[model samples]
Target chain A: MPVEDLYPSRNRTEPAILDRQDPIIHSTDFSAAPISEEQLRQYEEKGFLLLPEVFSRAEVSRFLNELNQMQQDQALLDSEVSITEPDSGALRSVFQIHHHNDLFSQVASDPRVADIARFILDDDLYIHQSRLNFKPGFNGREFYWHSDFETWHVEDGMPRMRALSASILLTDNSDFNGSLMVMPGSHRKYVSCAGETPDDYYRHSLQQQTVGTPDNHSLSYLHKQYGLESTAAPAGSVLLFDCNLMHGSNGNITPMPRSNLFFVYNAASNRCVAPFCNQPPRPEFLATRETFDILPQRSASQDRKAG
Target chain B: MPVEDLYPSRNRTEPAILDRQDPIIHSTDFSAAPISEEQLRQYEEKGFLLLPEVFSRAEVSRFLNELNQMQQDQALLDSEVSITEPDSGALRSVFQIHHHNDLFSQVASDPRVADIARFILDDDLYIHQSRLNFKPGFNGREFYWHSDFETWHVEDGMPRMRALSASILLTDNSDFNGSLMVMPGSHRKYVSCAGETPDDYYRHSLQQQTVGTPDNHSLSYLHKQYGLESTAAPAGSVLLFDCNLMHGSNGNITPMPRSNLFFVYNAASNRCVAPFCNQPPRPEFLATRETFDILPQRSASQDRKAG
Candidate 1:
């Protein structure tokens, strides 16, 4: 597949050009870069690699409009959307967007996402879980540092760390907004940071999908070993992180609202293995059991009519 | 097993007894009554039926202790629990309890929950989901009226309304605290009160999980057809309702807190068919795909040491 748009846009015309010290942590695996031995090596070293400008500005604009239309739909405000701030009742995070919104479904299972997943997963794959997270400015929330795989392994019946998540920044993720922060090289060891899965919530709500994080003492120990880095990429950047990589985000305190789509991918062979755990794994929406081959890439942003 | 504990103690010495006009709504399906052709007919007419004292007071006591312990646990509060109010950050609800706490796992799979399922689903079945919803007094949140099946069908790929939920009361549901409210016989016809599933919140937050309610016109029609009734029952009562039954609860302003453990069951014949619809269904914890036959109902409350 053609990785970079040779014509280039006003923002990232020469795709995959990294401004080594641009302060923005962009990935080495973009359209031009693709998945190579070197890029894999870099991901291994850093635990996460950022892909800058996975979509053109036009594509990002279309997505933003569709999102706005859905959010403002009064019908939706009263029923389906939930709030993170109970007092203010402001929107925080959403789930199953791909199922409800056709555009998102395509974006969620886009060839790009599948392509990247195949590089790491190295086998047929399917989406285990998908969600859209928004860090609203000023009233945003903080996701404490922890590993995603910790809960997946213990609760979701995921047997190994073969799965990973792609954080697609639909908006410009500035430092002020709650951008994703990760502890480099933390994935080397499986940190049992998740003290216990509050097995009750699994049946009641989807809050327990992201496993719990480590304690301060253990966190400090890890921090001492591997320094932390915040992802400050522009709009449309795709960040792929190992499932076990320790990561989190700060509450947005600025006027900039940050949002992203996360799609978790797992190899087909690595389905849930509940074994002896009485608690059942997550539902199909969050941790899908079925696996499908990577879909052929259709011109996602080009489908203007669908958009 | 002895249907009733002949030798009465501080708790239920007998499995079930009826004080006819206890003010609390008791099921006709208690010990004196079991699921029969008559009860099924009544359910078809009412859209919901009550089953009282599924657990003994001693069992409820142990469960209550565990819930209290979890809510107060600093480690749990920090890692596993999910809060509704971001600023005050009070405990609103919890998820995955069945996974973390063994007591909850058994309670989630209680035979009582399955017995009701057998009558409704009419086939071999499995747990679709389990959760503990707490309407804490004063700080409790309101659950706007809506149907659970609407969301499951549109979002979770559920093919039929062969599923039902048993809201097992963990605490006495008084008028002051939030209690399960329903519009009788609403399940006979699929209201389609929910218009197009606003796919936006599905990604932005969990609001879309329970598809929002109908507009004023449609709601008025529903109300006119089937008036609302509050499920004010004592602790251990089980309120079983059809999947499409329109239901919700008002926010609790009273000092009494209302909590319930809901276990959803679905017939094995039906499963999710996520065809071309873009939006994905619920996560594994909220909408499980795997099917397991009913577990033999051991005394869910009797597993002492674990509790």
Candidate 2:
């Protein structure tokens, strides 16, 4: 039998609203889960879970220092993995931090973080994508609303909804600043976006997306049905959201800037094939095709206190 | 049968010199070959062939205009694909030009260029890598002596020695300027350089390569055996070199800047697999993993006049 495309999107004339066929949580047992039962319940209900102060100020500061070092290194800043804002030329995103930098790799593998992902994914996990996103004060541009899976599935060939994103705040995410915003319980439905995914969509979409976007009608419907919630948290918080969650953020008009270390964790079994839309798979930095267990041979509780 | 691992280099304790194990030309039939018989003989003998004034001056000027536009766009310049000189931050190289820009893609597929590659490789081809290398007057840095296959085999998983590079000079390459230098007939020997290829070698190697470099002893040996030759040509000239050829360039100290559009063509059958060094594969822009016939139906001579 041909592999069933559980969620089909992109290359369509009209927008679609399909019920998510896959389970939100694949793991049947949560005996060694890092997050609490109540937290899991909230995640299942809302498609997102926020753990406050998961990392200490010192850890966040160290990450910030590393980020500042990378930003200062003109050689690294010049490479294709680093992306700057279109207008101000301020650094916007540095991709593949887990592979590019040593410290970031450690941060990604930290049990405090990896365990949560292991529990949520319910399988051996690997980094599908890792990046450091920066929104400089007053110059940061807005990211329009859309489901990440729409692009990942169409352009990256991600098979199912067995992926999640973890964003570790490096700075305070206030109500005014450009913190991430998500439509509550949006992961239950997959939004099949309109428009054909043109070749090399990530080239421009990294800075500003014009394709593979959720239609205004779908956006309005999701907004009215579930309501939008923006994250307002202190530094060191970790925000985990489902792959199909409808999320986007406004541009920062405030004086303060917002930054986060983002990593997408995918089940090793759900690794990518050829793109669903029949275009070439995106670069590895954008949507990794390699599959290797990130926290090999270590139980979730092994490094709980250490991290 | 298990595939033979020929031309293995990295992960060994020390370097070793190996004889050429593969044929220089894979295509047996030359009925529709684009290059002259003498040109093919010269390439087989020296592992490189230079064609002067292949592109007209007017065509070169348009490409330069496109390059200038890309460099002036702060956003394009800021992206990771646009690498800059380490000391000067002046634009140095842009990776994936064929995918990023339409005009360059047309140039890559042009019969004048693609036909030469087809006649040499003797098989259907695809882009292994595409980049625009710029050496700005005095700010440009030197690229150290190394065999591209050494890195491509160990870091990118290129299975065989069936790849070659075509560099189109966009500016006059005088004797004093930083034009490419090659050791004639050096493609017959493979230099197994010392040291392990560290992860994300391209991150730092793009600015300056510290790893996967040939030892001074090996360099001196090749220099003494084959002697060195540097390209001196006007705009619109084309330089084709084998993948295993020993090549490097001096930093430009002259006031005249040097620039070229470079594209690597590889036989489709020799696509990448797991990296030979046991590290993860480099990003797609540096070394492509895709395998599709580029010029599926058109005969080489068909587009010769059109180009």
Candidate 3:
């Protein structure tokens, strides 16, 4: 079926934005038509699941165009954008534009996306950050195999809260174009590249000896041993995966640009500390009514009737 | 006394080479003479201990000169180097120069420095990655309060194995000069950050968050509540602290640059993964006869005569 047919008409409008007068429900009701339990289990076991046709081709194209334009503008302002080495591939400036765009904000707060997060996390959720990974065909380098959680855990200690990640493909995805490769259930076995010793860890050639890089081979071997699946979903598809899942992708070998929008959300009750950029939530973004009201509503009538 | 007069002239003869056969043992014995049981306990409770005159003035100056020269050369080749806006007070570059120099390798295996690591870690140790942090007068930004172990645990999720860190100051450290400020024993309590969520942990922005910026009043309040101590040690001093300790530094408000070398070490038995950069130990630096001779002789001597 055409991807467009799967999406409800744009006129359908997202469930009307809730207001302050409407009672706020902090609890999540997973009983509603949400991601299936089977899917959730698969994610837990394999570390990742595919939600195909999450974005229509048109939407993906729109995002890609917007990203390209932003990159062009940033290149003019900062030479950092143009300083790509053949070894590192493209050194695109991240965190520069998407934070301000509406499309990004919409995807970040999309209820459908949030529903999947709620299902996996089994709780209310908050959008932690949005990322626009721009992999231009000309400068794309092969990303080594590793886990996102490995990187995150490197910055903070192991956290118990269940976490889920959703990657929205803003352009057509294929093996030729650096589609993400994930090792199923690798998240359950959390291992550092090297052992707890600094000597065991791999240090980047340029980094000081005490620091080590994530173990790429360990990840690849695990994926091979476990028979992990790689989702080469088309554009507009979203891949929801366990945060600890071992995954990475090679550079886009195709002749076209590969862009994707990544939205990360954590359980509402989970302690939220900002990750990479030091900036806190802009006061305006926090003030949005959508931020306050998008949580699952459990009215007395609905609760009693359902019960 | 002039800085040069503070050390014996013969100190320069060794040039801080690592013994290959028992690199771990040789490295940890050089400074072991001065480390007392009381000092070890103090380090455990306070999170960090300063070692004054660990390096001679000549050694420190030599390292600083090398770093400054490397930065200048890198700036010409890669345009990533930049001066801060409004005031060109701080020069910033994220260049990785480990492959080009042997300084880091020497520091990583320095016997005097490793001896202290072994004493605190209570086992054979290996070098992790190292970095040169040079904060020119009034140029560096204030560091946030956080723990290295907290960050690393998120990445490795492995059992703790004598993880420790050392900071060697090559310049005079004072309150006005960007000396380290640490909260003793805060490493015992781990706090969660936004990036800890498994989902979207790899998103670029997730990495950008700081532990607690200087402007964060809450951090100050917590530091006060935690009985944090700001350290001011002289040049050639070394501070060895637990990886989990909460620490950070203020900007170098003084007129001169504050240069320091950070060496992270873990127990030798620990398995390390390779870093993103493919640089591993060159066969020549791996093991040496000196290490083999010293370790066995020392172990035998101790067996024959208990202290």
Top candidate by TM-score: 2
lDDT of 2 by residue, A1-307 (tens): 4456777877678988999988888877766566777788888899998888888888889999998898899998899999988877889999999887999988787778777777888988888889999987534566767788888888888889999999999999864455777888989988888778777888989988978877767776776788767677899999989999988765553335799999988888888878888678888788887634454535445436422
**DockQ of candidates 1 onward, in order?**
0.01, 0.01, 0.01
TM-score of chain A of each: 0.78, 0.95, 0.67
Q: What TM-score applies to chain A of candidate 3? A: 0.67
In candidate 3, stretches whose alpha carbon ends up further than 4 angstroms from where it belongs are A1-30, A75-93, A96-98, A156-158, A195-213, A272-307, B1-307
TM-score ranking from best candidate downward = 2, 1, 3
> Which residue runs of candidate 1 sit more than 4 Å off their true CA positions?
A1-33, A73-86, A203-211, A290-307, B1-307
lDDT (10s digit) by residue, model 3, range B114-222: 6666666666765544556667642354444555643343333323425677888878876444477777765554433331223233222122333211123333444
Cα lDDT computed for each candidate against the true fold: 0.61, 0.80, 0.50
Q: How much DockQ does model 1 earn? A: 0.01
lDDT of 2 at A54: 85
Ranking by lDDT: 2, 1, 3
Better of 1 and 3 by lDDT: 1
